[model samples]
Target: MWPEGIGTGAGSLPGADPREAAALVTGETPEFPALPELPHRSVGADMIGRTAGLLVDLAVEVVPTGWRVTPRTGRDLRRARDLMSADLDAFDDACDRTRPGWVKIAVAGPWTLAASVELASGHRVLTDHGAVREFAASLAEGLREHVAEVAERTGARVVVQLDEPGLPAVIAGSLPTASGYGTVRAVRAPDAQDTLRELIAGIDAPVVVHCCADVPPIRLLAGAGAAAVGIDATRPAFTGATARVEALDAIGETWDSGVPLLLGLLPGTAPRREPAIADLARTGYDLADRLGFDRRRLARLAVPTPACGLAGATPDWARRALALSRELGKAFADPDEVPAGGAGPA
Candidate 1:
């Protein structure tokens, strides 16, 4: 749905000011501004904690071993809901002031949430297929309500992004057990795809699956009917011959299927130094060229994003990063703004 090169954050800004974060996003990305995620506020405000509020008839409590399922609603779950309500209020205020067109909201995908949360037995919910299914159903219903509320409050179209940072680990069987002495069994690709597919189908709005890992199962996600697959443009290099070859193939397949790629071209964390806009834009241009697509096609098929979340960044850098990300969007929209060679002028 991006007309010009639209800018968006990966998720998670640096501070607790949802209003300020929302204001920055609305100011920079006029076309598509996302609800800013602020994990630095700690406890229930983190991605996992905030999304826990969406589960139907489910409750979670923070433990020494992270978040564990509870038999009934507890303070932890209440805290999560309270923080989420505050964020929404802030977002509503910001939207009323800025009047954005379309706003994006992020939640942990089924796979990621299941991987992060623990059952009453102290094992990950992903370890139990039945639990996973129930969690997915709950999440689907919760997100529907959340999205409808957001749209009604802001008077803007709502788009949902499912952050699946743990999907790669789930597929690879890399996550440790609650004891940390063993790894959980890896999920097969087909099963993973099926779970995600069903989950995406339940969401009422457009869904973008975000996974910042080096190998994010791009083809599987795109095939699962994700409108967009978000990945880190820098961490996942396209220069190598092994994984890069497979990644390139996946990118081509996803694009060929009419799916947009949310490219993380800008730094999310503080960079060693200020980055040149052309340098970042060139990453997308080069990627397009590698796939034998014209640079101009990137405007239609890509959404510029930060390399990852900005939770670890300085407040100043976070704002600067968002601004830079917007500049990259403009460059993608018009290559002449910053030539593909990555240098502005002779």
Candidate 2:
């Protein structure tokens, strides 16, 4: 794992400065740099413009269906790609002129992309193994170039986060079983693993796989050579007395493979203050102790992020949350100065 601080979503930048938003997302102080304020904009546009401006070096913006290409919609997917690419380039420039760090460019993983993208026949590409493989290769190539471009602009490492929210569902065959969806086809575990391995290998920087759902293919992700595995920390998979053992098993598996875990501790939508900070640290330490991992290694592996992105939050809340994440990160890194048992910063 990269052993960095918290990361928030590109919070809504509508009429808000991009630099400030970028700072918020990357845990930089508010006074770092201001960005262009884009008000009342679409989420996709807002994410692209604001994230690029935040000097994140790398980020991903999910375009809603209106922007996505579908046979039924007859929308030009190329146009969407062009717009996203341009925004990334602009963001890359902003990073060069301002903050310098690894730039992260993200995209939906191939399986998720196939699950969502519809062909002219109204069939989901995910059902077709051949088609899915092709899509995965295409995405890998595209991201490879995108990473290269971001690197050229920022002269920093380019990490690619593969967002695969549907991975668990697919693995469980839930996607195929859902009504209105075609026959449930299982993805061979090895094939799925190989696809991700190839994608990660093609990238120039360390790779992280993020899955917010329960019982994600953590072992598979590690085998694929991912440097870190990000999962919801507040809502871990284990419950009851079995929770501790299960948690340890999970953490041990990842750590044994030398893959650090990014513990999602922050409640992205909640108020941020001392209480929140205390809660986050306690949770981090508790998990570490249960997992039998070194507190220091846990500190380095534990990136206190929101359970997910904060696009749903208010601007003020998002800002405060970002600040709290940074503060808690400092405390986690140096527990002696910031006691985990304390009631947080007053």
Candidate 3:
């Protein structure tokens, strides 16, 4: 779904100003800009809260622990909705003069949302199969409408990015229970795949499944019919001397299957040392080398991204990181053109 010389941010930016955030992302990655997510605004603007705003009939309220399912819509859900509405307004205005051909919008995947929100009884929604299924259905229907509205407003093909940062924990049963006394039961790979598949099938546009875990389920995402898989290449599972053989093998297999990877290569926050364009891109090159693919294949098979969200970054670094990611995209397309010096000070 990505174009040449293009890169994208991983949803969240550091600032609270939606107008500025939208302008910055679009100005930096004009070809395929993402709808900048400003989590710093408030709890409603965070990943879970933002996605919760897209529920059709269901509503959520913030509890002492986190978001919880509610019988009736409350102030928390209203605030979330208002924040989302404002973002859409800001994004629409930002693109008023010249709209991008494609815009990526990120939402929490079913598994992540289920794992995050608590039920009325205080257990995770994922703990009850029926409740989770209902939420997924609501999300699917809501997303269809949301996508249509964005498409109409921006006049661009909308690409849905399902951010599943919680998927690994769900698969491994590592999430603490509401009581924090025991772990939830592990979800079977097949079951998880099936739910994801159904959700993807429901969406009108192509879906990119993003999981920035130490070892995201590349095979499972591919099996679930993801058009692209987003991964953190800087993680030990995918890079460095300690990289896992299995992780490399899975990544190689996914590439061999012709599913492009959204490779997270740039630092999300300010690095201790400034890095050259070539330096920041080394892991992607090494990954291709280890996979036995031609170095040039990276240009077509990978889309560069920051290591994760920029919520923790300084505003300057966040902008610079997106700019660098775009430069890396060009470098991947033509390795000979890397600039001479390091990317300037943090």
Candidate 4:
């Protein structure tokens, strides 16, 4: 079990009037703090800029794009590149100011990207395996360059996380069939596994794949050489008590395969009571026990986190959640002297 840090999706950027987005490339706003902020309409660059400004060691970028290429396509790409570069600069400055162990950068995985990013002919590249492979290779190269930029700026090791919410869907053949718009074809498990392995092999950084959906192709992910798999543990896809039991068994098997699991335990919404710290600890312990792992291993394998990002939460709630998470982590590490049922000093 690895003692990985808890993670959240990118936080909101500092803005004018708590609603106006600052130009990511050129804004005079002070570096954003680690706490959450008032939600303002923001683009991918704004999110990345603010995240980097906050000194977050790791962040993910989800740029918006049309199904078909638009008039501002080149501009959008340029903006994205510039924003990423700026974030790398910010990351470097943070490393100089407050050194951290490692930094992470995440992007949508190739298969999911192929499904989402449409071509000029209004067809998803997923239909063409050759094109999809090429797209994956290109993305890998782009990500490698980005990783190198971050590493050069920060002088810290880089880890790449690939967000693949659509993986389970693709495996289950639930993704819509390619019709006249495109030929929708399901990727075989082995082929998908090989493609992911190639993508990971191409990048120099350690790779992690995140699926907020059901237990992903766990064995496949492990086989693909991913260091870890992130899943929404609090709200698992299995139904009923029996299914839950079975799911735990499966997770244990996956762990046995050597890929550590990053179990998400935080609620999507922030909790009201500070005393919820105890509940959080208990939840972590319970999940570990059910998964056939020892409670002591909890601090190692389990990264207590909100089931998802706090973007939808109010600023107050998000701040509270982060504070609570840090506090509970401390408790998990050393609980003997801490008060058993109180919020303590979060």
Q: What lDDT does candidate 1 reach at residue 92?
A: 88
> Between which residue pairs do clashes occur in model 2?
14-38, 15-38, 15-39, 18-35, 19-35, 22-54, 57-103, 58-103, 58-104, 59-104
How does each model score on TM-score?
0.95, 0.79, 0.96, 0.76
Q: Tens-digit lDDT track for model 3 on 226-331?
A: 9999999889888779899999998999999999888998888898776778777777788998999987888888999997899999999899889988888988
**Poorest 10 consecutive residues by lDDT, candidate 3:** 337-346
Candidate 1: regions farther than 4 A off? 239-243, 339-346
lDDT, model 1, position 221: 91
User: Highest TM-score among the candidates is held by which one?
Assistant: 3
Q: What range of 10 consecutive residues in model 2 has the weakest lDDT sum?
A: 50-59
- What digit string (tens of lDDT, one per residue) describes model 4 on residues 1-346? 2233333332333332321221221121112122223234334343332222222122223333333323333444444555555555554554555444455566778777767655555566676777677667767777777778767765557767776777777766565643544336678989889999998998888887777775666667778888777777766543325346556765677677767665555555645545466666766666666667776655556445455555566555655555555555555565453455554223
How do the residues 1-346 of candidate 1 rate in per-residue lDDT, one tens digit apiece?
Answer: 6466778788888888888887888877767878888888878999999999888889999999789999999998998898888888888888888787888999999999999999999999999999999999999999999999999999998889999999999999999998899999999999999988998898888899999987788988998988899998776455323337778888988888899988887676676667788777877887888898888878888888887898888888888888887787788888877843443312
Two-way TM-score contest, 2 vs 3, winner: 3
Question: Ranking under TM-score, best-scoring first?
Answer: 3, 1, 2, 4
Best by lDDT: 3
Error of 4 at 179 (Å): 5.8
Screening candidate 4 with a backbone cut-off below 3 angstroms (N, C-alpha, C), the clashing residue pairs are 178-183, 178-184
Scored by CA lDDT, what does every candidate get? 0.86, 0.58, 0.89, 0.56
